[model samples]
Target: MRKVWVGILMFWAGLAQAEEVVIAALGDSLTQGFGLTQAEGFVPQLETWIQSRDASVRLINAGVSGDTTAGGLARVAWTLQPEVDGLIVALGGNDLLRGIDPNEVRKNMEGIMRAAQTAQVPVLLIGMQASNNFGTEYKADFDRVFPELAKSYDAAFLPSFFAGLSDGEGPQDPAALRQWFQADGIHPNADGVSLIVEAVGPKLEGLIAKIDAVGE
Candidate 1:
């Protein structure tokens, strides 16, 4: 009886130790792996990277192609299920591309963040910058939106998630960013998405660590 009880206790302990950390990757085509297949997308690569470090993470890819901030807002409750422990929000690219009002984008993002906070999920806001060709005023408005939203929401901020990528400048001779894009000239290739996962890994780890520490 003693030996059987010990074995049962050990089984429970192992199960507890193997609990998964659920993470949600929510955004646009970039999150959906636009240029490449789903397996090669950012979230899959990120999940692989996370598992390499800690094998218990489950990263959910909630990306929607052609999804705008409004769409993300609409689907937040359903998409961000209760299992979500952390959220990586990579949005607003389509908003800027569509020339949507910066204020509207801000409002939508704020609403999303509010919902995340209410759910007690940690958030990491991925930022994007508009093309200078959009004019200085428009670029400024779009560029400033992310930082402000990050600050207001008290979320981790990644300034210009594709900071090194070029808008045009020729894909072959892509302004030092050729290596990070697929043939599409817009969406990140598998290699490019891998780079992003690598760049953001440390930040994500830090946030996870902090959360774990608080529970201790």
Candidate 2:
């Protein structure tokens, strides 16, 4: 009876530990928690949100300020340690700011997807739109890169991560964009991070369930 009880305890312990899921929010300053303290950035806040549900999901912020798609690609291998279960790819803003070729962005992002596939991790791509100032041709190309990649990769696609809060016409619908960003008009404030957490929480939850089922 003693031995059986010990084995049962061990099994439950293993099950408890298995509840933990590590999520990598890999991108630029946004991922780095720009304009906010470590606690306020999306990663920490997102973890809190996850905890509110399962209390076991971990969010790893791998944001690099001023990083381009190529930059993200360069570091993909090292960042995607096998223990990680999911990825939030929020890049290419710098590329758009520099007016880099959309083709380059697409290629770089594809590389990212390939690396994640090699690691057997699911990805959640955060798409960004080109600033309207960049001209229609450039805008179209930049916007197209994300959906194209999402479809090809079969990743979770948040059509506009910052959708309703987007720069121009988006925020006009009272209380849409203001709640997500600070006065600076750049980084997401704490409230904004909360909104993000709310938006992505369900999807992350579903992903976790799927992974758990497969592991079982």
Candidate 3:
């Protein structure tokens, strides 16, 4: 009957809506796509990357230019909206740049992780390595903050936001790696973002899988 067909159509539509997965990327300028255009930034490239694999997902960009781990901690709760089913935490770059102590960065990052945990949202945490200029002890301590936190929470982890840029032969000079970065020698260029997305996209796909573990 016509009435039975209409009811079935609406039921299917509601089923489709319930399966949608929304994720939030919480970070600093890198996540904010700081020098890049609307389409060329990290979130857009990442979204394109995921959809190409036939996954349905939406990403919320919660990146703030010049924001530090402390700032991320402050804003994480609101970023985890009711619709957000997953998260990508990529803060601490600005904190490293400012020479903030690793302990403080770790504490702030832990706070963000706790907020996500409380919200019952899955997370994919990406981190940045410290420059040697920050000194041996500082570098070691800063480098450990991210992985340690990820381990504590059992969240997915990527050691560096720039993981795709490395040649993997060995350490390369910053001057040598300039092709991938903007003129500021800080934020990555569009081409650089492309490489990063290719490498980093898979890990986030895993997060999506975790969030959808219940169904669809």
Candidate 4:
């Protein structure tokens, strides 16, 4: 009986550990928590938020400052290790900044999603909106990349990384959100990350639930 009880306990412990999923966030500085302290960065705050909600999910910060879609594609295969249960893809901001051709951006994004798919890891893709300064045609093409690929791959999707900062009428208004940004008029400050965490946290919860449900 004692040996049987020990076996049962060990099984439970292993099951509990298995339920705690590891999620890798792939992106640029936004995911990396640039211009902010380690604890105040996006991944940390997001992890705290998940913990607060009683989730057993851990986030890996795979954000590189100033990385474009090409950069993310370059690193994604290695990012999807066997232990990584899910991924949050948030690249393309720098691609927009550089006005890279939307087709190229889309191709890179496709590569990333395909890598995640091949690894059998689920994905939560975060979109980036292009500046109107890039031209309306360009903005339209760039904006379409994320959602379209998400559908193609059956991946979860968010319309924009900055969706947390929006007032719901339209795209993020710079003047309205000026206080939330750093001096460079880019990158969210600590407080801004808090707000973003609030918005993205629920989606993350959904991902965790999916991971648990599928036993991934």
Question: Among these predicted structures, which one has the highest lDDT?
Answer: 3
lDDT of 1 at 95: 92
User: Against the hidden reference, what TM-scores do the models get?
Assistant: 0.86, 0.85, 0.94, 0.92
Q: List the candidate numbers ranked by TM-score, top first.
A: 3, 4, 1, 2
Which 10-residue span in candidate 4 carries the lowest summed lDDT?
164-173
Model 3 CA lDDT for position 166: 82
**lDDT, candidate 2, 5-28, per-residue tens:** 999999999997777788788899
Per-model tally of clashing residue pairs: 0, 0, 0, 0
Candidate 3 lDDT over 87-188, as tens digits, reads 999988888889999999999999999999898898999988888888999999999998999999989888889888886521257787799999998999
The worst-scoring run of ten residues by lDDT in candidate 3 lies at 167-176
Better of 1 and 3 by TM-score: 3
Clashing pairs in 2: none
lDDT of 4 by residue, 84-121 (tens): 99999999889978889999999999999999888878
Q: Which ten residues in a row have the lowest lDDT in candidate 2?
A: 164-173
Between candidates 2 and 3, name the one with more favorable lDDT: 3
The pairs that clash in candidate 1 are: none
Query: Which segments of model 1 are wrong by more than 4 Å?
Result: 1-10, 164-173, 213-216
The C-alpha RMSD in Å for every predicted model, in order, reads 3.5, 3.1, 1.9, 2.1
Model 3 residue 94 CA deviation (Å) reads 0.6
Give the true-structure RMSD of model 2.
3.1
